[model samples]
Structures are given as structure tokens and as C-alpha cells.
Target: MPSAHRERRRVTWWVALPAALALMAVVLGLLLLVAWLRLLPDALDPFGTRTEDRTGPALLESIQDMSRYEAASGNFQVVVDLDKDAKFLPDAVRGSRTLFVGAGTVGAHVDLGGLGEDAVTVTEDRKSATVTLPRARLGRAALDADRSYAVAKERGLLDRLGDVFSDNPNDEREVHRLAVRHIEEAARESDLTDRAERNTRTMLENLIRSLGYERITVRFAPPSG
Candidate 1:
């Protein structure tokens, strides 16, 4: 009976030894895995999700011919603070405020296409020439999407909920339009047109000089009221 009891105890020890080693191995493997994950970069996480663009190819749009010469371009930037609030309602319930930084470019052009037959006058001896051109005009403001962005946004609880349900949440068209408007106004107030006219005059003078015209006079038409 003593021998049989000792044999049973030995058998139980052998079984428990393998089980303990297996549990230790499993814990060590888990620790190693956690360390490896910690060392990995956030962008390279194995369990992280990724986004893809499944948009279709672009379509062909109509093209138009351009004859005007772009003489000068001016870059502009503005800060736009836009706010909306519901009448008689608290700001927390139904209000929104956004601060946007807008960057854009406005170009001035000379419309050579509008020149008529009588636009240029020359001396009878062909020793000099006088050219008349329309005053330079400002082109449309082109916003740089890469440089323009929203600096801050604050939306009420109701407004935040609307974003979750709306198809085009937090649409920026209004802000973009306002920024373009401001840029256009600034361009109009600046001397971009005068610079453009001066550049155009210089260009025409050089060209006319190359044609052996000793005296060249460039005149721009007055801006119509």
C-alpha cells in the first residue's frame, strides 16, 4: 500500500508540471505580443482600420477659349468669423460660430479681344505709333483650398445633432463665398489694376520698339462709370 501511494503522487506531480509550464509559456507569449504592439507606430497598427477612395473617374466638361492676358496677380488672406443664432434661444441650444482662415488669389487682365480697328493710330510718316487699350479689370477670386481652412468651430447641441443627420454636414460653401467676396473687394480696392495696366504698357512698348518705331505712346481708356 505504501508503494502504490507513492506511485500515485509521482504521477500527479508529472501532470501538474506540464500544465504549469504551459500556463507560463502562454503568459510570456502574451507579454511579448503586447511589447511588440507598443513598439509599432500608430499608423502601422495591425488592428487599425483604413479608408479608401472609391470615387469614379472624372467626366469631360465643356471648354472655353480665352484671349485675355493675365498681367498681374495678387494674393490675399482674411479671417472670417461667422456666427448664427436662433432668435430667443440660448446659444447652447441653437447657435454656431466658426472662425475660418481664407487664402486666395486675384488676377488682373488686359482684354485684347475688345480692340477695334481704330484702337491704334500711327503717324503718316510711320515714325511713331499710339495705341489705345481698355483699362485692366480684376478677375474672379480663386480660393486656395489647400491654404484655406477653418480655424475653429463651435456648434450648439441641436446643431451638432443636425450634422449627424444631414447628408452634407458642416457645409463650407457659405464661408467660401464670403471669403471670395472679401478677397474680391480687397482686390478692387488695391492697385492691382494699375499694376496690370503698367505691365501691359511696358509689354506693348517693347513690342512696338522692336518694330523700329522710335516714339511709342500707350494710352488706356478711362474706366466707365
Candidate 2:
């Protein structure tokens, strides 16, 4: 019985020895692989990741012909301070304020599409001509989203809670609207229209000169109500 037990023990040891060796070999191979990956450049890695763009194609929208001549564009920057307070409530309970820096551009254009048949008058010899154009007007203010930013924001306890549950919590549309209005007002106060008129006149004069017109007169029509 003793001899039989010794034989069984020897067999078990032989089986476990090979299993342990195989496990050690596997562990050594994994360590070597990790070391190689770390030491080698990513370009030589067989398991390196690849980048691909899977974005969908862009859809084209409606297109309109441009008839107005954009003569001048003014860049504007403004600091906006907007406050919202609940009626009959203290600011600590229900109030919000934002300090934002906004940037935008306003364009002045001459509407050549409104010209009538009598807008241009030429002498019989065609040596001189007079061209009338509509007064330069300002276009919509285009806000620069990349350059505009919020400097600071303050919200009351209730306002904070509302933002936490609101779907459009960070909506800055009101502030943007105010900024645009302010920019438009500034543009109106500026001489951008006068500059646009001068530029348009220069362009027309050059064009008429190229056409062999010795004398060219450019006039702007009165602004209609």
C-alpha cells in the first residue's frame, strides 16, 4: 500500500510541473510583449488604432442671387451687463445676471437691384454720364460666436435650481439679442454708411473710366420712408 501511494504522488508532481512551466512561459511572453510595445514607436505597432471619418454628407440649402454691393464692414466689440430679477422677490431668492463680451460685424451695402431705367443718364455724344444709386443701408449684425464669451455669471438659489432642471439651461439668446441691438445702434451712430457711399462712388467711377467715359457723376437717391 505504501509503494502504491508513492507512485501516485510522483504522477501528480509530474503533471503539476509541466502546468507550472507552461504558465511561467505564458507570463514571460506577455511581459516581453508589453515591454516591446512601450519601447517601440507607435507607427511600428501592429495593434495600433486607425482613425476614420464617418460623418454624413452635407445637404445644400436654397441659394439666392446677391444684388447688393457690400462696400464697408465694421467690426464691433461690446460689453453687456444684463440682469433679471423676479418681481416682489429678493435678489438672493430669484435673480440672475451675466457679464458678457460680444463681438460682431455690420456691413453697409448699396442696393443696385432697385435701380430704375432713368437711373443712368448719358449725353448724346456719350462722353459723360450720371448714375444714381440707392442710399447705402446697413445689413443685419453678424455675431461672432467664436470671439464672444461670458465674463461672469451670477444666479440666485432659485435660479440655480431652475437651471439644474431646465432643458436649455445655458441659453444666452436674450443676451445675444441685446448685444446685437447694441451693435446695430453703434453702427447707426457711426459713419459706416458714408464710407460705403464713398467706396461705391469710387468703384463706379473706375468702372466708367474704363469704359471711355471722360466724365462720370454718381449720385445717391434720397432715403425713402
Candidate 3:
């Protein structure tokens, strides 16, 4: 009788101990979850607001500031020809010209010199507009166009090689090697036209920014031919 009683007591304690521990663990987990939920708003607000809420207003202010600067300087001739295709425009013009300003400073400086008349072309519909800007008009912004161009040229070479040997990984590597060889050959063959173009583009962008036109828009014309 005594032994059986002791065994029964041990069994009860074992079962009770595990059950209590499990209950306590569950309670602790719930409390932690509640605390996290309460703190989430305060902790996440800054990052969330910076990425989603502040972007639009910030961009608008930048555009406005740039526009004001341009207006005050009164030194630019913004020519937007609505009779050309957008496809032929230079990459720089397509990318940088989209920035719209209403009244404040820009986060990044723009290099507008790469903008060219040759880049202006008509769209398929002929109803849109295209722009042709002079190199002098782009030099007013803060970014260094020459450096950008050099970087672009280097990346462009790699990108071209990637396009050529996209099917086979081994072929891709070989193509890259061949491309490098060709680039070296070309550089040895001439007076570094790539570098010259970069420098020229940078100078043009700086000149444009120096002038008072903050923003330039070119709507493309529909293509007739």
C-alpha cells in the first residue's frame, strides 16, 4: 500500500509539472506577442514613412527648387520639338529629363549636356513631341557627366557582350574575353573616342544647368515614315 501510494504521488507530480510549464510558456508567448504588436507602429513608422510617405513631396520640392533656380538665372533656351520620335533620343535625355520640379533643391545633381538634337525623333503616331537640346544647356546641374559617361561606356561593353552570348554560360565568358580584346584593339587603334565623348557630354550638361532652365519636356510626334 505504501509503495503504490508513493508511485501514484510521483506520477501526479510529473504530469502536473509538465502541464504547468507548458501553461507558463504559452502565457509568456502571448504576452510577448502583445508587446510586439503594441510597439510595431512606433518602431516601423520612420522607415515606412521615409520610403513611402515622404518620396512624393520630396521629389516635388526638388523639382520646384530646380525650376526656381532656372527661372532666377534666366540663362537657358529650352527647345522642345513636338515633331520627332522619342526612340532615337540619347539614353541620358530619356532618363534625366523626366524629373519634374515645382520649388526646391534636388537630391541628385543632373548632367544635361548629353542631350542632343540628333536624339530627337518622331513616334509611331506622329502626334507626340520630341526634344533636341544643346550641350550647353545641360552643364548647369551638379552631377559630373564625364564620369557618368565613362562608367556607362564600361558597363555598356559588358552588357553588349552579355547580349551576344546569352545562351551558353561558357560562351558568355569567352565572348566577354573577346569583347575585351576588341575594346583594347580599338583603344590602341584610335585616340580614345569614348573618353572624349564622356568629357564632351559632361561639359554640355554642366553648361545647361548653369543656364536658368530647370526642366525641359519633349513630347514625341507619331511616326509617319
Candidate 4:
């Protein structure tokens, strides 16, 4: 009986006792990890996801859906000075002259929204492509109010007297308009349209080349009314 009890004690010390202690340690570690994670306020994703697969058809549709493609634009700067003389009486009697100077900018652009289905053509072997685009044109000019300012202005005695009793405001708005008009006129006379056409051609050629075409031909159709 004594020998049997000794053998049982040895087995517990070497195998069963160590196994039970290891199992308890594993459970304790798991419990501590759970508690630590619960202390954090936000849940965290272990795996980072950033990109997705993009298909060719989806990309093509997006390009076709564009309503306007600005091939090129020019920012034309100008300074303008204007004056107007006013009088309540005959020519030299108590007349007022307004001399004002202002500066501003305008833009010239091209339109490509008129491209039709027949505009693009690809060869049978897909080695070459021809793209027809509309001629470049100027769009509505925009004024950069932040960049524009009145350089100088002066109102004569008659004008100041008229303003004291009249509800009419100063002619600053009109002066600004004239400055913008001058910029537009100057841009019209420049080679902005020609530059836009050349840029458009280069852009189409590069785009077609990116699509695996060895040779690309770009042409501009006659302008439409």
C-alpha cells in the first residue's frame, strides 16, 4: 500500500499536475487579452484594405459621360482706363469727368462635348486609330475679382455734388465691366485658339497611344454654329 501511494504521488508531480497548470495558464492568458482589448474605445481592423479592381468598361463609360473637356485655356491679363464727362448745364458749365483705371483677367478655351459616335475610328488590326474633334472655341470669360482692383479713380466737383443728392451709385461696376471686355477683345486677337487646337491634337495622340495603338491621327472638324 505504501509503495502504491508513492507511485501515485510521483505521477501527479511529473504529468497530471503540470498538464493542469499549463491548461490554467493558457486560459488566464486568453482572459487577460480579452480584457485588454475591451479597454480600448474603438475597434480596429487588423487587415488594411485600400484598393479595388477597376474594369475597362467602367472606365470607358466615365470618359464618355463627360459633358465638357477643356483641352487648353489661356489667362489673359489687361489694364484698362476709361473716363466719362457729365454736366447738368452747357458744355463747359459745371461739368464732371470720371477718370478711372482698373485691371483684370479673362480666359479663352475649347469645347469637346460635341464629339459624336463616329468621331473615333480604329483599324481592323487595332494598330492605328483616328480621332476627329471639333474646332477649338472661346468660352465664357471669367473675372478674377480677387486679382483685379481699381488702380486709381477721381470724381469731378459736379459728380460729387450729384451723388450727394442722387440715389445713383458710383460707376465702379461699369469700369470693371469695361476692363473685362478689353481683356476679352485682346484674347480674341491672340493665338489662343490655335494653341488650343494643337494641344488637343497632342492630347488625343497620347491617349490613343496609351491604348496600345502604334499610330494615331487627330483631325478637327469644321466649326458648327
Highest TM-score against the true fold, candidate: 1
> Could you estimate the TM-score for every candidate?
0.79, 0.74, 0.20, 0.60
Model 2 C-alpha lDDT per residue in residues 1-225, reported as the tens digit of each score = 999999999999999999999999998787579656676466765555679899999998988999999999999999999998999899999998999899999999999987899999999998999999999999989999999999999988998898888855444988899899999999999999999999999999999989999999999989888
| Model 4 regions more than 4 Å off | 1-66, 87-103
Q: Rank the candidates by lDDT, best first.
A: 2, 1, 4, 3
Candidate lDDT (C-alpha), each: 0.91, 0.92, 0.38, 0.69
Q: Which stretches of candidate 2 lie over 4 Å from their true place?
A: 1-57, 169-171
- Tens digits of per-residue lDDT for model 1, 55-154: 9999989887888889999999999899999998999999999898999999999999979999999999887999999999999999999999999989
Provide the clash count, candidate 4.
0
Q: Across residues 112-141, which tens digit of lDDT does each residue of candidate 4 receive?
A: 676678989998999989988777777755
Worst 10 residues of 3 by lDDT: 68-77
Query: Candidate 3's residue-wise lDDT over 79-179, tens digit each?
Result: 11112124655533331121111111112122243445666554565434345432112122222223211111222333346546774344333433333
TM-score of 2: 0.74
Model 3 stretches astray by more than 4 angstroms: 39-225
| Comparison by TM-score, 2 against 4, better one | 2
